[model samples]
Target: MEINRRDFITKMSAIAALSVLPSSFVAAMGNEKVEKAKPKYPTLKCDVVVVGAGPGGVPAAIAAARQGAKVILLEEDNMPGGAPVDMYVPFICGGPRVGVFQEMIQVLNAKHTIGGRTCETFGKTGSDGKNHWWMPGSYAEVIYQLLEKEENITLMCAAPVVGVKVKTSGNRNQVTGVRIMRNGDYQDIDAAVTIDATGNGLIADMAGCEYMFGSEAKSDYNEPVGIEVADGKVQPCTWMLISERIKRNAILPIDKLKGSSAVEDNLNRWVKADDKEDMIRRDAGIYLHWGRTVYCKDTRDPLLLAQAQQEALERLQENLEIWHEAGYAVHLAPKLGVREVRRIKGEYVLTANDLIAGTMHDDVIAHAHYSFDVWGMKIPEEMKHIGPYGIPYRSILPTKTEGLLTAGRIISATRIAHSSLRVQPICSNIGMAAGTAAAMSALNQTGLRSIDIKQLQDRLASMGLFDGLKKK
Candidate 1:
């Protein structure tokens, strides 16, 4: 029970499994021999079986289930809140249109859910100048309840999808069902259609979908602003932290540090700005946990990345000392937030050009409005001041795989393109889009590649996707 820094490090090693889960989860598996009787699955078949209940996966499963299709959502983690609950992603930003998203937020909102009353928007997040709003209770319960309340959906936890059962009809190979490793036993679940909202495209790759890894070249996508990405170098992925400010915290606001706290910290920085470089209250919603940390990482060297994470933690701890010096106590969180991972390839790759052009697709299912915000050890001078962008349907469908789709930050887009598209709102929308596509394909008895785009678009519009658009 005694825990010191050494214990913390050891515990972190155990917890690193969260980002990738155990290699045991990734261990190739098939029908394993068992002695006694096997447990029955949720059902022999479902309209859609979405793998991984992350940002996009949850929404996709919900959409399909709502669309009158039987759904089964699988997650390796026990509870289904995804990043919000598992990690201290305490402050969620980068969402727009907010009707459904806001309803979800309101449920998680401290006002309605926890008795903390406020609907205030905080100013620019970090030096990035991105607007963020606050809510309470983490919203994990609210999201899970919504899915559970839906009669058409089934939820499965601690089930790692090993692969899929595929069948080829003509030149197209479609995913018929999935193979999963549940509690050390390998089994199969047959479904009419399947979704690869697994984030890494575990389903898409297994189903033999064409894919790409890392940032795309500017020439490849023809995005005028595309960067020439280098090998062994990514913008870096941050495992973020969220900590709440303790009672009587004295962390200085950027404004107060600048000697300006007469105004509300959140309002002054986020809304009323005398100039673009205006400051907000630094302590607003400050979690006593990991404070002012970045996930910039080197994927090539695990040790190097681990060191970066540690350094970030140290710096954050130093800030906690700052809180203590200011006469407050700091409570650090248990886990870190993830920023980047492997994105799955889709049929039509969304490019940076599509984003800059403010492109809309006839089959546009989701939209994102975030900056070309790349993270790393440092922010390059060239990369700054970018804003929100778009995501297209092509980015969700795999190139050579049918009955499969990807959502969230792992969609098939160039890194720069994904940089903008991977917002929380967009991830939720794509989840809905991919789930609906799988459900519609199953219900209509068509290949995922051949689902009616017009119908899909109309349904999405009905669900409040891409609203306020002149043309959808």
Candidate 2:
């Protein structure tokens, strides 16, 4: 007799619960101690394998599952929700309502508000908008529940993809399978299609696809803005800390706290400074400017990342104690808010010119309404506040790699353009398209480039997305 997935999960959970029982409890039951057996691992196969499970990968997994494809969502963290929930980003950024962004607003009960305060104009007109403030941990639960409803989707947390198996066909290479590390055991996942929503293009790198890192030369795309040569000084990562006001309590001064001397000095200076941003208020007793910007050569480097995390925690601890004395409860997020990283070299590379001119392409799959909001880079004043532009399907397609597609911040775009499209809503849109494309490719036994673009657009339209892509 065959068992269903639900039954398997229930039995596994029961075994897990029993394994953790106290020795005394087992002895009380008069059961003899038995030697434990080694864990059994099995090879898994799926129609689609999506890595990252962040804002982008979550939707990708759901979209593929909705298409009746078996999907494996691999995440490095214990849960989904990506930067918005993990890093405690207060609200989703303003964008056109379509696709997952529209669905998420309805499902998550998101309210259109500014700075957590109600605004009739912005809410009614629905121009520039942000969701009402929410805790990341709570929002993570919402994302988890959403994924759980998809019977075809299997979400594995803390299971990182260690390798991508690739095979060369004549001149180009194709991904065959992937190796995953889960609980000191290696598991192989063979998929018909792979989606690289890893934010930093980790799978693409493992597949040996051509990719770009940091900023590109202004001459390369030529719309003006950004560094002249490729460099690692793309954007500074931020650590967001949350705080709430309460009754006053006894606490020590900020100097005695175990914080970086430089951070402590900055706090001391801010105390006496009169020209601080509105993010800090004396009456509020809680500061939102607690998030710190840190410059690191490589955000992926374990040593550098650890240092950044340590610095963030120290700053958080120092502020929490200071705020505690002033009647506030402050806490820091466990994840770092990374902005920019690796971008796959796709069939078409969207540039700042495309964004500035609001260019529409023949293969437009989605649209973005944002500017080149690059931080830590020298962006020209004229390059600011660009209007809506269409994102091409070719931009998400790898140039020489087959059987794979990349979305989210890893999509093909110029450095200036990435800063605009790297937000949650836009990334979700890209993920939806990628997932659909992957599903179609898997079902038809075709490569990504061979998928019927018009048919894919029609499917998206039926699902109430891809309004920007008009059928010819």
Candidate 3:
């Protein structure tokens, strides 16, 4: 009996879903709802595919490759280094001391691009001590070279992932591949496992995974740092700029400026940069204090983006003029420093309590040591502690999505918990864990949830990471 094209396609999709879905999902499919049409596109197959070649995506690709998987890394930008190159956020926090973090510090030191510890505002060293800093150019270049050294990793730039190919079986949805735009055409790339290191939860959102944006109420997660009401309001994003000191004589007189008297009034107050201790501490000419912030929730709105950018530019222009008198010219940041965005709901949602307690989990794969640093938001009492939190393997696992895991700032965490984990070093560590887990899942022909947590932890330990978990 000949079947109709629609029927045939439906049957084929079921077969594909059955081939890849976990046992639990397959068992639940008997009573599952309607079957949907499978996507059709030009295809490429790989062991694993990672989206967004930022700080997280880069390390993720490298980790999967080092695990002997054929990996493809997709980036929307022409180059990698999403934050450093695109966002111009040159700060690398003291998060992880091991694994890729150590390698990065060593590389920066060897290249002489590592700036010694810097003090708060005006470049003055704080009594609390200084933290390491590096030029974005050097950091991006080193990351590129590192990716190049990995034979198993294929880096694709200017390829933005637009959609996800999900095969739903029973209660679970498995991401078979991602639909990406390439050379003005859409194409499908299949993978056994896909890592969402986009840092904005873009892949997870497209995959129909459960996620939350902004803030959650304290009662929701029993979070001390949560707000009284869940309003999704998060810390604002900053537009950072680079500057260089020039001779003071290069500055034009305030009377020669073209602006309202109100603008001039503010400029007069802000231009006193010569002896202000608030302005003189850093060796790098980059000004951290001179930033205009817009909420992350409003970041994607075109009108909001335009308005925020204009405000940021106007503020930057004023700072430039002020610095011009103090001998500094400005270089604007390429992208805004977005502090928070979509927090994908994962198998385990880490909370502020866990971070403050430095809770250890048996399945821990990575570690983050950073203070709960929230910009433009009240720091709750629970977030005030200095912590070395153990990030478990479950933190990156999407709650209902099979064949997918998260890395970077997009991992499963409460808004307050994320404030600490979103730093560069911690994100890189999470990337390595996600990549390693993806490789294992692909090689074992198992869904990401089926991979043995202990085995994954063991692999990380062998890689000279996850040692912190031993103490617990």
Expressed as tens digits, the lDDT of each residue in 1-472 for candidate 2 is 1111242233334544565322111110111221121214686889999988887798888888888889999987887877877676645553545665556555454432213434222232222333344556656767777887889999998887776655554435577666676787667778889898988887776665667767777787785776676664557777876655567542223333332122111121222232234224323343333366676677656688778777766656655566677665666677777787678889999888898888979887776666678877756677787857877999999887788899888888887888888877678878887898899999788888989999988877676665522310
Least well predicted 10-residue stretch by lDDT in candidate 1: 22-31
For candidate 3, list the clashing residue pairs, or say none.
122-279, 122-280, 122-281, 123-280, 123-281, 123-282, 124-281, 215-232, 245-327, 246-327
The sequence of per-residue lDDT tens digits that candidate 1 reaches over residues 302-380 is 4765676686666555455554555544444334445555566666777766766667777677766655665543334
lDDT of 3: 0.69
Candidate 3 off by > 4 Å: 1-42, 118-130, 246-290, 300-303, 324-327, 380-383, 467-472
Candidate closer to the true structure by TM-score (higher is better), 1 or 3: 3
Cα lDDT, model 1, residue 3: 10
Q: What is the C-alpha RMSD of each candidate to the true structure, in Å?
A: 9.9, 12.2, 8.5
Query: Which predicted model would earn the best lDDT?
Result: 3
Q: Write the per-residue lDDT of candidate 3 for residues 163-230, one digit (tens) a residue.
A: 67677665567888777777766667889998989878877766666777777788888876757887
Q: lDDT per prediction?
A: 0.58, 0.67, 0.69
Model 2, runs deviating above 4 Å: 1-40, 110-130, 246-290, 312-320, 467-472
Q: Which residue pairs in model 2 clash with each other?
A: none
lDDT, residue 434, candidate 1: 82
TM-score of each: 0.73, 0.79, 0.80
